[model samples]
Target chain A: MELGPHILLALLESAVSTAVLALTAIGLALVFGIMRVVNVAHGEFFMLGAVLAWWITDQLTAFSPAVGFAVALVLSPLLVGAIAYASDRIVINRVDYDPERTIVATVGLLYIFQQISLMTFGPDARPVEPPFNTRLAIPWLEITEQGWAVYWPWGLSITSYKLAVIAISIVLLIGVWLVLSKTRYGLIMRATQQDKDIAQAFGIRIERVYGLVFAAGGALAAMGAVLIVPIQQAHYLMGGDPLLLSFIVVILGGLGSLSGTLVAAAIIGLSNGMIAVFFSPTLAKILATLLVALVLIWRPAGLFTRSSR
Target chain B: MLELSGIAAAYGRVKVLHDVSLSVCEGEVVCVLGRNGAGKTSTMKAIMGLLPLSAGQITVDGTRLDTLPVDHVAKHRVAYTPQGRRLFPELTVRENLEIGLMARGEDSRVLDWVLELFPRLEERMNQLAHTLSGGEQQMAAIGRALCINPRFLLLDEPTEGLQPSIVALIQEVVSTLSKSGVGVLLVEQRIDAVLSIADKVAFIENGYSREVVPAATLKTDRSLLEKYVGV
Candidate 1:
């Protein structure tokens, strides 16, 4: 293989890993950043999303694949968000959203979600058919090629569906940015995140805000799950890698900053993708863990923390 | 009009405020003067529903409010600015002020009004709250509370640490608030600074709320001010 195709393949893998990893990590960062609650159930939320998406798509496949995928995309995240909202009210709020106590509660929630998915999903690993799957034969310049004419590489190729996931993630992330930066709800969320006590005193209804943010976080994770379920099958335990990767990214990014999360996700995803392609995937995971440990020891505030002005 | 009668507040089993009674009506300033840990802050917190009252009732406009939550109390036309000028330190000044009026369900127009009240805020409208000087922070805190247009304002040590110029600015703002028929419940460490604007001064000693005296009488009868409030 020529250097051009080799580098292109590495970049594509990086893009793929970056897209999904970012989608997963943003939710975790959001929940941790705003409510100061470490959502142990975040992975469970991701799993539930993928499982639910599978079920939704399976039910809708009677129609067109595009229609099935579209409905599942909309419905899966919404369902996850609703469940998370209820859990926040019933469990997290009961503990008063206390740091230690909420962690325990979320751990409990994690098991509960996993168990329920195992029971209802029947412990089966299932995949959703992609809405569209078209292969694009990648082009590269060969040294012996006549007058540097464009030529299709022998093996380098990418599927349209993977490209779609990358595009969807970009859209979803921008949507989050816009909602947080442009909308009144975003202002309220930022306010609550800054000072919960003051936000409450100012009649921001922080408890309600907490519920909403928690749900939104879960929903984002689920959205990522829905997009990725076609490439990776939906299993009761499928959320583990995304969860671990998301945590690594969020930790590397700086715990609460969204921009930090994105940049960190890109680094983690790209590295993981490239490493997994060249070596063993297990090696990639080991390297990611080491990177996280290093970042934790070095700049715990995150790589992107804006200095206090 | 806001009134607290026989209010008792405690942290754990340790009572912070004992048998505290106070009232502030429109066009009036009631200053609570006490040294550090004299339960002046405790009294303010109790009224703001930050701490649970072991005994007594709070009323505003003839309605009981002692049982309500801090936010509910605010909705009933009572706004509180806790000590340390606790603005959202990371947020811009405009965002900090907006949170104040958010309780009242007001709009950006209130932001203009707040900036008008504290012209200094307009200059640093986009700066983070933490970056503002102590005087500007205090002004932002007061401006935020005032933005709610509450019938009653509870300020805890608005002029705790400030230059005379800033103190005078605070004094002018408090007086104007009082003149506008907004009842001012001010907590002060400096009796002299507040004496000019305060209609009534209540002294707290240790955990006990002591005598309430007319601010005018305290000018001539400096003994009470001297004994209860050191300097």
Candidate 2:
């Protein structure tokens, strides 16, 4: 592969990762921003989604792979959302959403979710078959002896499933933006985020809103996991990387900022993909960590937030 | 009538309000006047259910309000504009008002009345609440409370930091609301502002409501203001 094709392939790969990261990180950011609760078990929700997708698809093997994939896509996130809502009501609400205690509680939740998955899903890494996947060769524009020429480059291709993931993610992101901006529920949620006391004074049942937000956050992570399950195998331990990456993205993007989360996801995702392709995955992670440290030292509010907050 | 009788409340282990009592009938404005830390704000909080009453009772037309939750109080057609003009800063002025309507599941019809009362807010409806000037923020806060179409309104220091013109505008709005049969319990430090709009003034001193007197009485006898408010 030539340098141009390699870079292009890396860019394509980065776009896929960026899409998934934005979905997952936005979940964490919403929970943190509204409830002021740092959900440490957010990644476990992703893991649970992947695990549930595998289970759902596996049980439906009598049907077509596409049918099973479609069912899993819809069912997994809803189940994850229910579990999250239950956890919020049973645990997070009981702790009064005290910042320090919620962290410890969510950490405990992370372990509980991991252990439960281990018990039911077992230790095996399972892959869900993509509903539809076909390799599509990408052509490169080259200046040849006859002037501009287009030729299909060897290995310069992308899977249809990966492209679908990108398209689906963009649609979902826009939908989320619309809901938060144009809907009455969105206005209430923003009010709750700004000041809980004032929100309560205005007759907003904040506890209900908190439960819904926590569930929504989990659902978003699950959706991301469901989308990526075909590419990445489901394992009890798969939650750790997404969790760490999301935390870095949320912090780097700016706490509670949706636009910041997207921008930071792109930066981190592209850099990670490019660096991993060019150098090593370990080196990419190290650079990301260094970037986070620099951000903390200089812009503690994150890259996109105003200083007043 | 909106009434608070012998209502006592505390912050943690410390008592802040002791035997504070007052009432406002329909189409009346009752102002609670007190010095700093005289439990004027705590009384408002207790009525709004933000602060739990250690004793006594708060009732609106014989409905026990003290037993209800903070959010539930607003559902009963009671609205509060707290100290510091606590608007949802990131949201637009329009959104802040709309949230008040959303609480009661009411439509935007009430918003027109609020805008009419604060025309300055109508001009800045699309602007973020935090970016607005102090007077505009106060207008937005009061406008938000009005959006609920409350039967009884509790306003804590609504004109505390506003300019003279804005304060006069607020006074006119309160009088208008009272004439429209809304009961208002206004906590204020500005005696002149309070005297102009308030039908009766309740003085609070050292965590206790000292006395309830007609605004006309206070105009002739200034000793009560000197004794309780030290103004």
Candidate 3:
């Protein structure tokens, strides 16, 4: 393939990755931004979604793949959100949301979730069939003897399902933005984020807000996982890579900034895809880590943060 | 009436407010005058249930405020503007006021009253709280407290770090609210400013209420201010 088509394929792949990554990282951003607690188990919520999607689709074998996928898409995030809410009330709230203690608590949660998935879902990597995947040949522009012409390029195409994932993620992200900006609930959450004691003084039930935020964060991660499960297998250990990537994205984007998270996801996702296509996946990971290190050393607060908070 | 009787509170093992007693009847402005570290802010916090009371009780119109959770205290038609304005910095002034309104479950109609009280705030309503000038921030804070349309308002150093014009405006607002039948508990260091608007003055020293006297008596005798607040 020519370099143009190769780069185009890489860009397309990056867009897919960026869409899913933004969904996952926004949840982490909201939790940290509002609750002021590090949720190490965030990626586990993503894994749970993927695993649940596999299970739900398996149980609905009598139905069509599209029906099973639709049901799993709705059920997986709800189930994951419930689990997250329970953990928030049972463990996180009990810890008084102390930063250090919550980190340790969430790390424990991470292990528990991983173990549960390993025990119940088995150690094998399971795949869920996509609802619909139709590949269309991509045309490349070329200068012929007569004039500029468009011709179908060999091995240059994208699946309809990937395009759908991109569209769905865009809609969901817009929805999240609307909820945070236009609604009264968003005002309360933003107020709580700015000052917990002051918000409490203003009669905001912060504990309830914290619980809901935790559940929403987990649900967003699960939603991201469900979208990507058809392309990536549901493995018990798949949570680790996403967790690391999200942490990097959150930090690079500026902790607790939704817009920053999206921008950083795009940067990191595109670079990861480009590097993986041209070089190696391991090199892409190494370079991404190096980029984070450089960002921390230079701009410790983050690239998008206005002040040194 | 909003009453704090023998309210003793501590921060962990260190006692801050001991034997502080004061009250504000409807249409009264009661100022708590104290020097730095005299537990004036602590007294306000205790009344707002921000700090746990080791002993004594805080009641608003016969309802026990101390027993209620910190967030629930605002539901009793009591609003507190703590020291330093404490507005949600990133949020717009309108949002800050809206949050206060939300506390009492008041409609947007109450916001019109607040905006009228601080008309300067109306111009700066869309600006972020942190970006406002000190006077404007104070106005936003006071306006936010008023958004709840509270029966009693607790203000800690509302005039602190403000210009004379702004301070006078705050005094006028206090008197206006008092005239509207809202009990006001003000913690202030400026004796003259407090005396101008306060109906009663309670002096706090070393975490204890030293004396409670009529504002006219304190104004006539500067000796009490020099003795308790060391002005």
Candidate 4:
């Protein structure tokens, strides 16, 4: 059970990737699961979070870098969620959340959000400093000429912010689980998921619930973006990778099942992280896409679900 | 009280209900009997605002309802248990009824009242509704509707495909609900079972509702049931 420093570092990176991927994919799954909408614009919400984080930090840097980053972290997801709520009310709900039409609408939403981010954030990739000092050395046993020894090597430094991201994500994911399982809000959403018509018959305002769930989904995407902007710069086109990876997770997990999305996200996220660390990020993405194809062909419902829905 | 006078509704260009009129006073059990595809279900759909009325109006205790949305129709204290139970299959019995309670922003206190009515539901309160048998599913559906404590209880084929014992159970429940002053508008095909509790009866035919009469009279006259229901 002895682990090398290189392998340990790679494992850590994969865990981080898994956490971010879970956050991104869960929203896609939620939208599909509850409202039966394929939100192609999910990544745009992520990109918008990073873009807003940078802008907010830039504006608030005058106060203090710490204050600026803190404010942006809190505000970005809320703003993204609010915008998503408005979009649901305006476009998605208008069409009654038709599965086919929402795909088109969200694709339109993707472009609209991208173009807006482009006009505002510019074509250049923007960077934001972490709220706290991120650099830290990870200790691990290394096999060298001497023997297996515990040491922190030159390139084995772990970022404190990355660990924070992992911690925050774990808490947030747990919070989401509690919300869906324990709260009335979750109860209502689950009801809507089973049968929108029947839910309406019980006096549920399904339109309002749809709008809020859409907002919550967007907010979740923004959450990951806000946490990861320091590691990955804010770029208008950054949404492509996250969106694709999320689709992979949601498809592998089973569309519309949150618990299933969590399991699939862990698998995809960890593997992609591990692959990227050993090989290349591009290779990681290729492998993930290949896995998506395999899952879709074999078990389209997802890994956790017993059968296709 | 639910009253529909000259109400007409359609799906697309095709009209399902050309003309329908029916009424159920407080504490009254009015069963609508008809053959298949006779607009029996369509009449309930129209009253629940599931379909846009092509013409005419729907009123509950003198308040306008035809123009209300499907969810809003429930807001007026009208509960409809559609055909096939339609309980949220994934939800636990408690959760399904909670959806009913949540609809009206009420408390979990209604659960106790519901459990008392369908005591079988009390034991399976935590079980997923889909796991229940046909009779149990029907009980859960009725329990969910009653959680709303709605003024009108609309049942579409409440006793369809049930064992005689279960049918008798539904009969008792419907009778109790009506006696408790919850107006019951039942859509059923089983004439003999429905007439056991129905105070009045209406027959929907060829997209129109007619043959309105007292159930007691219809029960005595077997020829009347044959002539109207034509079974």
Score residue B141 of candidate 2 by CA lDDT.
Answer: 93
Candidate 2: CAPRI quality band: high
- At residue A195, give the lDDT of candidate 3: 91
| Tens-digit lDDT string for candidate 4 (A100-182) | 89889999999999999999779999999887866898776657899888866667777888898899899999999899989
**Predicted candidate 1 versus true structure: per-residue lDDT over A15-53, tens digit per residue:** 976897798899999999999998888999999999999
The order by descending TM-score is: 3, 2, 1, 4
lDDT string, candidate 2, B47-84, tens digits: 98889999999999899999987889888898999999
Error of 3 at A276 (Å): 1.5
Q: Considering TM-score, which of the candidate structures 1 and 3 is the better prediction for this target?
A: 3
Docking quality band of candidate 1, CAPRI definitions: medium
Across A1-309, the per-residue lDDT of candidate 3 in tens digits comes to 999998998899889988998899999999999999999999999999999999999999899999999999999999999999999999999999999999999999999999999999899999999999999779999999999999988999999999999999999999999999899999999999999988998899999999999999999999999999999999999998888889889999999988899899999988988999899989999999998999999998789888652
Worst 10 residues of 1 chain B by lDDT: B68-77
What part of the reference interface contacts, as a 0 to 1 fraction, does candidate 1 reproduce? 0.60
TM-score of each: 0.95, 0.97, 0.98, 0.94
**Candidate 3, B1-231: lDDT as tens digits:** 898899999999999998998889989999998888899999998888889999999998889999998899889889999899999998999899999999989988889988888899989989999899999999999999999899999999999999999998899999999999999999887888888899999989999998999999976788988998787
Question: Judged by lDDT relative to the true structure, which candidate is superior, 2 or 4?
Answer: 2
lDDT of model 2, residue A33? 92
lDDT of 4 by residue, B119-149 (tens): 9998998999989999999999999998888
